[model samples]
Target: MKHSGKVPDFQDFVECVEKANSGKINTKVLSIGDLFAWKDCTSKQNLKCRGEVPYARDMVKLTAERGITYLLYSTKYDEPCSKVLNFLQAMLMKNFPLP
Candidate 1:
């Protein structure tokens, strides 16, 4: 009953994330660069960018306001991701109040 090619669904991914987060993914992240190349495991797709430093900073502030312990950012081939990680590690390691 299929006449045209169809794309795969991401239902499994959604389920996985929900389960992994234990139905509570309070911690969020702001990816400022390519964050999918690793998923692809190749350079066929381009996803490099720069802006994670400021992004992470903003995220930290937001998380504080929202009430979270930590933020996560898994990026690949992203200059911003590298820069932000370095900056976060070097500085901004203080207590943040939540709402």
Candidate 2:
């Protein structure tokens, strides 16, 4: 994602999951676009810019507690909070697989 500057086609992945389930299941994408927007807005206000300023960790924590699988398509891996976010679990370090 850092090298390509592109988000993956999340819809295609959802479709594949639906097909694999014989169209019996549906998937929801909790996009990080809104999170990025919030971070930008907070920056404009000169708020506290801690490593966890965007609080992606909080969202991930909720998902973990709820047993929800998180498939993140992030443009940043070298970010300050990347390590703190525990990327070792499901983080895809490679660029987004966009054709």
Candidate 3:
């Protein structure tokens, strides 16, 4: 993966997973941050940024569709914890509704 100081496209993330599943690459860990780092709000001026929403939704959709296991790690200092949690909950409910 190219670490060109830019977040990779969602397709890049899928390719990485495919490679790892096929044993073509050694990906020890994958985080939600790695996929949405491009949308990070680096400045307090943009604290209300919701740029990662669409990406997060897509990630959930793709993972559910492919029956892939996903792990999410959040740091208390990254952003508002409630927002992250709420987003995750909504995504999970929408993609994997509980009967």
Candidate 4:
């Protein structure tokens, strides 16, 4: 998987999920983004930030690829999930309700 830091590229993630769904591989769980800690994207000093939101075009592609499900986990309302959602909404206004 192509990755920057610990976060894998969103397109790569979609591809792996598709592969697993097609029975090409047996993957039960796939994790993306940060699971250990949250980093602010607006901060210029957080060079170790792991919250790289998927690209707008990549997010659109993910929606088009059926059979993929995702869950959001967060401890705070104004956290990484919100940032991710905001980024997705800004990128894919028409495809907000990802199938």
**Which candidate number maximizes lDDT?**
3
Question: Which residue pairs in candidate 1 have backbone atoms (N, alpha carbon, C) closer than 3 angstroms, thus clashing?
Answer: none
Better by lDDT, candidate 4 or 1: 4
Give per-residue CA lDDT, model 3, range 1-99, as digits (tens). Answer: 453334368766756565654567654456877666543223332323545533343333121224422333334444432233223333454465322
TM-score of 4: 0.17
Candidate 2 ranges beyond 4 A from true positions: 1-9, 33-99
- What would the TM-scores of all predictions be? 0.17, 0.25, 0.17, 0.17
State the displacement of the C-alpha of residue 50, model 1, in Å, after optimal TM-score superposition. Answer: 47
| Residue 51 alpha-carbon offset, candidate 1, angstroms | 50
**Residue 31, model 2: Cα distance from true site in angstroms:** 1.3
Relative to the true structure, candidate 3 reaches a TM of 0.17
Candidate 2 lDDT over residue span 16-88, tens digit each: 6666645787767777774454322122222233334445553332223223223232335443322222332
- Clashes per model (N, Cα, C within 3 A): 0, 1, 0, 0
Clash list (residue pairs), candidate 3: none
lDDT of 2: 0.39
